[model samples]
Target: MADINEPVDVLIIGGGASGAAVAWSLAETKMRIVCLEQGDWIKNEDFPSTGRDWEARQFGDFAISPNRRKLAADYPINEDDSPIKVANFNGVGGGTILYAGHFPRFHPSDFRVKTLDGVADDWPIDYATLEPFFELNDKMTGVAALEGDPAYPPKPAVMPPLPLGRSGEVIGEAMNKLGWHWWPSDAAINTQEYEGRAPCINLGHCGSGCAQGAKATTDGTYWPEAIRARVEVRHRCRVRRIETNEDDMATGAFYVDPDGVERFQPAEIVIVACNGIGTPRLLLNSASERFPDGLCNSSGMLGKNLMFHPYSQVRGHVDEKLEGYMGPRIGTWSMQFYETDPERDFKRGYCYQFSRGYGPVATAVNGMADGIIPWGAGHHDAFGRMFDHSLGMLAICEDLPEEINRVTIDPDLCDSDGIPAPKITYRLSENSKRMLEHSVARGKEILQAAGARDITSKTIFPAAGWHLMGTARMGTDPKTSVVNEWGRSHDVRNLFIVDGSVFVTSGGVNPTSTIQAIALYVADQIKNRIYELFD
Candidate 1:
């Protein structure tokens, strides 16, 4: 491989959303930054959408879950104890390569879940502190939406919102009739060709990787600027552990290069940007004699408090042909129930994402499997009814952190590199169940209002662990948290975390935007305190 013994001023692991953003932000300081990505860079041509069998390809190579995709660079996750399956990517762009690009910001109230609802612990930092960074990230990523969303505070202008396609228009009309809060969604996809990227062509399979290069995958957005700024991004480099010095401070990382050669890259400072699960996995695997439990896990919360948004989905089939497969998959959503309500039985709330349903093959298969369409004589008729008439709503339920729900090392399972895989032990809390029940009922009502002849809802989507968070929470108390407000490790002075693992609470919406904003904020924090960071 390349020069493994090179000294770097800053070493970042995982070139995903947060890693790329942090690299770009720190690149402004002209620091020697290097990022190690477990997977290779995903070229736009690698997307399967250009072929006729793209729909079937999703079941194999483009599958969201690493276990299903089984790419050489992916690691195995032991999800036997969890109801929701783990879904993530291992490429240079990370999950952004497969995310739907829904860029909704976390509500202000999300930071104070304990102070307001007496549930999870409150974050050390508030929403106001992150607002500026959010705006900066929004501009950098080309958010496509409007201001004046009642659900959120005032913000900068965005590109014109995605068109409310036939499905969205119908659902919006229903919500308006019902007097519920609804708005066009904020998306990371470019609408007017910002930052040398082409506008979205309404690619149908955004979740399977945006082949058009319109969606703001980090490979297209941040990494380009970071490399231009002289940041070295090493792909297919799987970091197994962080090597600490005699003082128990991070000094370097040990990883395996693409050719299965072990290498060491020394650094003055180390930033772990691997997402929620991957971050903790690396830390736990880096156990040393000075810190036997795990590096930076002096609080004994290294893999505790695992949180994934409990998600549910409902699909409706109407009589009209809506061309549901022609546009973006999850463009428009409603936050009417995003905030807390005294009348609701649950403590927190959930958001509803209204969008066109899956492709014809997926819809038909799901319909036939669920017995919604009979197999004998009624198959053709049922398939015909659902082919172009399917619309769906996803309910992202807020997940409260509990010590019992956690990510631990699987003694029996390991990745290709022989590192202990992450074992998730999670179950939905009562509040989450109640919130999902309410959401499903409301979703059915909205669908019925849209003239849907048949409707179906599932309490939990089997493979909906996209938003992993809170494995290593942030707080001011060193005894209760792993990192400080600025993502600096309490136990290791030179170590920092800039990923979803530092989340205090899981919000009711997508976590990618918040993850990036926090990364940028942490990068600024490190930049301002570079000389005195470890003091």
Candidate 2:
């Protein structure tokens, strides 16, 4: 028996990026909204950047992989079967806590992949429908970028772009020499003071959590406003499953509190803002007598079509003593191969996200791993040369949805709360392999053109499973999708999803900005149809 709580108008799960956006968007309605988060809020001082061992903490407490962190809030993910392991954060701001803050909007053509490229399914909603929401989200998050980039349509910037440091200058000149398109990356990091947050002070490791409050994580951006609007966010409450009524409607959810007690939260509507992998895990765990195959999984698409941006990296050292390890990881990007081409070996192309070099510890560790630095006396000399002179680019390859790659509940694995853990079974597609080859070749060319020597490449960066998407995809047809265009579950009328799980196609760019936009759009739709929301 579980303790019953007061019913609310709406219940939101996972108070990360999408969850924060949805809560803030729906705050105007004055509904009794409550959000459940597994992890507690992280203090700014507790962030690794404030400490001396900041670089080492990235491989330990703040490591992106939940399995390595194994915190109380984190559930174990069985990624032994997959090559690219999952990288996520279970805290209030989710992955944004450790993200590079590289925000990029999906190209308009990204929405019509199937229509134009004759591969993958097109999104139920287009970039046009979500444009206003994107703009609104950018304003709220204080996105910094330069306008009039040839890669995307005219988009507004709330602040000036982050300065393109030495690495960006080198990459920019290299791309220009090759006649490729390069642009300052749209970043959620503050370049100037905005909304009470200070500007970035050239902090080297933005991924280990920004102590300066410069990066736009949801906890700093939307959560404050939402909290002021009376949206209740309950921390350390790990939801075990969503509870459903006999009518096949979502009533609320069953969760474990901080004191380790099972409780039931009743609500008029339920919205799942868990990311792609987490969303499917929750849905599949919420099985009932009437819905034995898992809630709203009649189409058998609940945990299928798992997609990750298969990533590859090409790095090299230049002769110049460049300050390449002292700013945001991604300063600029090349969209030269973002769209599809008839002459390409693969269908969809990839974006070249040029990044600064790593910190001292990271450089030494990576250099040793790649056999670039020896273990003895020569190690010091090798480390010193590669410390500040290295530059790299990640190939953010577009991973098309495939039914074979999926998230399944592990038969033997469970989390701290005894919830079944998610098992990832994924493989790099043939198209992705070919795309990586092309990306590596192009990346090497750019590095060589920049007078870089000792160039190295990783065809498949195994730990680069940062972008998780496409399991519970959105579409018009119920037979082919889990949710409708507006993010409502096909079977459960009062249930909605506003996370990357609703993504129909994984674009070549990072999904956080787009994920928040979709969440805001879904919130807008829920507000508009409040009267007939259950219909």
Candidate 3:
């Protein structure tokens, strides 16, 4: 037996990035909207930066991996079968709470991968269709960047770019010497006072929740506005499954409240904004007589085509003290190899996102782990040499859609609520391997140009699974994708998805900006065709 709640006009699951955007966008409709979040609001005072052991907390309570964090709101993901582990935050702001705020939009060529590279499937909608939404999202998020980047098409910055510190200046000069395209990163962290949030004061680690409210997490941006517009967000409610009627249309969802009691929330329309793995897990768990496979899985593509942006890191140590840890984690990026070239070994290409070095504790811990810093007497001297003298770049490689690399329900692993957990079955493609190699070689060249010493490289960074996408892809054909071009389900018309799960192809850059843009675009379509939305 379950307590049935009053039916609302719209019910949104997951109050993260895309969910927050959708709720805010649809608020103008004046329809009853309720958003269910698994986690509660995290106060700014509780952020890691406010504590003495901030760096230590990054590996513990605020760890990106939910398994390690072991928070009550988090559901364990069985990623033992894959090389790359899952990194996410289960909260009102979701992964954005732990992100470095390096926001980048997908290139125009990203939407036409098959046409340009003859590798992955092309997205049903092009970049132009979502350009306005991208601009809107940028304004709302207060993206900070420089103008006149040769890589992108005339996208203005919401604020002046974050100051290019010593590391950024060095890297930019190196790229200039190499004649590679480099630009200021479109960061979500506030560079100046905007939207009532204070500017970033170089608080060092932006990944562990910005205590100064500088970072543009959705909980701080959209959620407040949506709440003011009468959107009700219920925290600490974990959805077990979506419930559908006999006609195979989503009626509501069955969720466990904070009290551990089952409750049914009915809605005229249901929108799933859970991330890639979570969306698939919920859909698979919502199996009914009509949907023997899963809800909206008539195409059998609900849990297929999982893509994780393979990440690589290359670091170099300079003689001059760069003070790398004194600024935002990321500063500039290079799109020199973003587009595929006939001469390259890989079909698609990647982006070089330059990042500053770690804090004091991180540098010490990593140095010991890498055998750079020995125990006892030699420790202080070695740590002194590396503390603020290092700079690095992450090679964010594009991951093609592969049906074999999927998210499946783990038979043995279950969450605290007894709901089955998601298991990742993924492997790096040969193209990804070659792409990583090319990027690493180029990265080393740039570091050498900058007169760096002791350059080290790490390929396939095991814990770099921050970007989860493509499990429930959107496309024109029902046989290939779970959702239609408008993000509506092919099997269930009234059900929609607005998350990384709806991505058709995983681009080389971070997907947060593009994900929010797509959500806003879907919300616009729904608003325009409100009467025919269910048709």
Candidate 4:
């Protein structure tokens, strides 16, 4: 608990990518800033370098509480119809700490729906508006990958592209035979020593924190500058609510410290960057007499438009061992069919992340379950045989906003503090369904073209990758949005939501880059607007 003599200029919740970026952006503004994270800070060294072996803390640091209501998503709500694996990490940097570090920009078609095919909301801003900031974020984050990518936008590569492995190259050449556009996947990693971090060593086990500090997890990038700028980072602190005045202007936030001590920290402005799923739930839980239906849910849309990128996968086992698991978690992407084409019964596109590399523990368990023997002589032989040859390519589908998709407080559930937990209710939209069907077929085609002997495919889960977005969407129309294009809450003057919740539409590309761009844009707006308000 911070003893603030003066109200912090901004109080940010969740120390992940969005929160970290905003905190760094606000640095040196002479404004007091503080970020509260639910999980303790774990460094790159603490992250698992190899298999599940020697990773007790990484696998065991479950945020799941003794109580049922405030449950973190460790257990999948249902067994069947799961997307790959349910993933959730609560710490500074969120999934960015655990992400594959691929950094492909959303295509120009991503921002405009009516102009492209007429479905989703036109981004209040477009690629042109965001391109410069995207470049800035790529450079600041020490991203690896050369530009000249014809499938996407035009920009000088922030850094050189990562070298793809034999598996990736084989797949790339096959996909090219089909006349589809493909490129060396751009990544938020160092390919050749940028800043203080080393280049990626091609060890594919990136989902668990990079031991070499080559990946651009916030801990390796934004956090360093944030510390240099003198920003305060409070870990193991879970915020309960935003305390506001009669005018609905946020004055502070209430939080529980690591030792279960309750405290309040004052703030001139409260920025909620707890990602898409967590952000809305926080708002819905911030119940007060003034806000009976969540803090900024006057339109009754706090947790609406919930989305999970309905993803699918294509597995491959070439005749020759590709040694896929020995490379970085990811190395490249393919967006040949990204634009929405109604002629194909879909209104959006999908991206292919060709690196689905896994380590020994994941491989042994999953392979054995998939019918490779797990015990005795057969098990040992099968495990060793499949270890070096397994490779997979995943299809990341774009989901459109539907009224039925949502996140709400579970009336029956509560956290450690007796507060209700977030109950996510979601189903694939028709557009998402169409997108998935198309992606699955195309992914299978790519696998066969690459001469894969045995291939398998998987879909994206709402919980996996934690790329959830659009629950607290932004738009120009007040009738359908919670915030302005700049991410200022439509109803609350001094309260703003800066996470993935503000997206009117979610793209196939990862949201971290967009979130960073929005944070930078909002920081600028706050600076200019405050000056205008005072003058």
Candidate 5:
């Protein structure tokens, strides 16, 4: 037991979305479980927004991109070949640390993309199989939502909805006039203090890390419960490879500790919860004589079919002051165009989210980028023209899984731990482009209907890579996918994956809720079939 290669019943890698959820789900069991995270625990005081210079810090140190953050725990991602930038955090909470807590579930149509739309491949499991897990996770994480949305099957009780500020009212009214479906957002943010956490104070900078603990990050929610249940969490341990036995069965993981010493943790079952890119990176790097291609790449689909939501935003400047700087950044949303229509050239549809404009400093900086604010005396007036009066709508466009879009290891680039960085090679498909174009046009119309004069729209939103999906997709056939419906590796039964990488289709919504649901569902399957998992 004193050996570094101490054996355990289960070992989970990456303490992010699915990692934390799986740990929490399996905590009540008698099995010994341990999770390894590359980043350290985030301190409440480390949130920049709590300080006076937070706005400046937001652009500098607190930027969402891993390359920009450049923290000790961060692993560099080569995004030169990708149109959409990869933005994620390397901490116990993972990307949830900077996410806006937008927790939208994948639509039912999302699972049947290949059958219904003849575009992307369909998921092995349907929404019905995962619906119970979705509700269970919502109860655990405390979602802020409203009832009576025609889009969903009766949603279980969520916390009282977050306040829809003037911006949401404007967008809601516009959607009503246009005969579109709009609903208060399904967010992980607390409104009436659920569990032990406090309610959101309307701080307006949720993307910069919520200092008030109102936003439900994994570190703030699942990790605490998991730790209490005796799940050992080791921080600052970077996993280098997944080791396999002579029969090509997964034994455990080899990782590098913070003290620059190599360590091994043997386990009966090894689960990979590293997001789309990181999962592929670890697998591709763990090559052996038995599986020279990769541990689970016998199908040659390990790092293929990378999908990201192609997103864009339309910002409108209203005549009346809307105080756009206040309230949650993303609250109300419209899903009228969620289902694909034959009239539209796109295969799948997109969702529209009403967003509050940035702070005064961010607004001024944005104006400078667009040349709205010049160098001289014109700066102040141009900045004030859109300071507190601007409200925007973001269109989350569905991206199909294309074989060409993938995650590969960068041979030349290595991280701080001497591990090869993951290289993303992604581009929006023609279908995606058409979907984004149509969504932007509709967004401009909604902004105009809301009594806005100056409106600006773009094809690509700068910071929109928060939701990563695909790469190691789930399917029925071992030849076509990396994992089965239960998230078990088709080649190596002892290995499992419970992250966005198992997503077959890129749903036109935020993936945090769906990611957690998948994890919970997979964990339940493991619990039921513990003895037969590797059979």
Candidate 6:
């Protein structure tokens, strides 16, 4: 057993985007804060610079999937031949360090889904309650967007949008002719300068690691401010379990330090921000005599109702003469059908998009020309044809919540640490199936409108489930949800979660914005009532 470390006022597990945001939000308080991260701090020099080299960092020597064979659905089942992406950081910032950097907020209807659309469960709190937090998060994260972009709602972006190249312009013009709503995208990347970070240099490898320091990775944007305000981030520490007393208040947690020392870190408050996959696993693993079914699981919904934003995109070849890999990753989106229109069979809607960034390997993968076959000599010729002229369009569809789709620790699969890993069993609902079909159909229409001679679209989603969410969802009802509106676990008063895991619904938009907003809101909750929670 590890020795017991001196108890702090608060102990946080997983220093990713969720944990880091919470720490930054609470930095001004007078509490001794210590964050335990399982991954080490990696600098820009530590990452691969080339597109093909993405395989190294995306699936590095340290990357480990809970599933011995496959991680949930983000990637394919056989990863040996594919790019290694057991990828998620355990460091100061987590996956934000290597994300595509898109920052789209959830529509207002995303919050009260059950009430409005009569579909999945409603969030414990409504969109109005989270609106301020979203705005606060946008400014805090230094998002680049336009104030009056007709595409999305009219909110003032913190920074100017990085311009789209000829690719987006041509498509945007064509979209206009077809009466589609399109505009420059909102991104966590810097357009010029804000709060000490420089503007983006257009390196185009935002997914691997932004060496120019323009992309707003959590470590780059939040951790520095947090540390300066006295938040202590303990790197390479793996939290094993969270302990609570009979009163249902969290006491502390156990972990293994990088030095191989076993230690118990006690705290009055505990926040679990270990992303979607890690959070539920920790809660289920933290079983005790007091709460054998898992902490905060009185409703038996802690590890159930899993949600994954399974994405499917249409890859096409535009015949126009333009530069593809010349600018930032994911520059713009079309919001023509982002709202609930009965014309669309699904209760929710998907965002159609046109983005103009390319990595060498990513560009090579989908660069087949119009008249070319996809294999052998023909593949090489087609690959060369669209190498520079190619741009991509994708649609992010919403996956409705389902109780049967779950992430449970695979009894047979254990990592080197002897800890049981997560085994995800998921099947889409009829609603999501129709949504994918509709989104793909719209994508094909847009491609044809853009005058692409040929279109290669994928309406089927196989492994894009990396955006796992709602497994340990927050709600007003204890019987149906795991966390409260404030993100507190219903069964354990001292335990709180602030990540995608606590989401009640998977919004069509990328989750980073709401994830950070929730992190800030939960951090304030911890700060205002430390005494009530601890004593």
Please list the C-alpha lDDT of all candidates, in the order they appear: 0.90, 0.93, 0.93, 0.73, 0.89, 0.75
Q: Write the per-residue lDDT of candidate 4 for residues 293-318, one digit (tens) a residue.
A: 99888878899987667777666566
Off by over 4 Å in 1: 1-4
Could you arrange the candidates by lDDT from highest to lowest? 3, 2, 1, 5, 6, 4
Tens-digit per-residue lDDT, 1-535, candidate 2: 9999999999999999999999999999999999999998999999998889998899999999899999999999999989999999998998899899989988898999999999999999999999999999999999999998988888888999988987889999999999999999999999999999999998878998999989999999999999999999999999999988889999999999999999999999999988989999999999889889888798999989999999899999998887756888878988999899989999988898889998888999999999998899899989888989999899999999999999999999999999999999999899999999999999999999999987899999988898889999999999999999999999999999999988888988899999999999999999999888888
Deviation of model 2 at 119, angstroms: 0.4
- Deviation in angstroms for 89 in model 5? 0.7
Q: Which parts of model 2 have CA positions greater than 4 angstroms off?
A: none
- Predicted structure 3, TM vs. truth: 0.99
- Select the stronger candidate by lDDT from 3 and 6: 3
lDDT of 3: 0.93
Question: By summed lDDT, which 10 consecutive residues of candidate 3 come out lowest?
Answer: 321-330
lDDT, residue 54, candidate 6: 56
Clashing pairs in 3: none
Residues 340-450, model 1: lDDT tens digits = 899889897889888796787798788987788888898898888888899989999999988888888899999898878989999889999999999999999998888
TM per model?
0.98, 0.99, 0.99, 0.92, 0.98, 0.92
Ten contiguous residues with the weakest lDDT in model 6: 76-85
Question: Which lDDT tens digits does candidate 3 get at residues 320-355?
Answer: 989667889999999999999999988888999898
Compute the lDDT of residue 438 as modeled in candidate 1.
Answer: 92
- Which candidate leads the pack in lDDT? 3
- Alpha carbon lDDT at 275, candidate 3: 97
lDDT of 6 by residue, 409-454 (tens): 7666554455566666677678877888887887777777777755
- Provide backbone clash counts, one per model: 0, 0, 0, 18, 0, 4
For model 4, where is the 10-residue window of minimal lDDT? 62-71
Candidates 2 and 6: which is better by TM-score?
A: 2
Q: How many backbone clashes are present in model 1?
A: 0
- Prediction 5 global C-alpha lDDT: 0.89
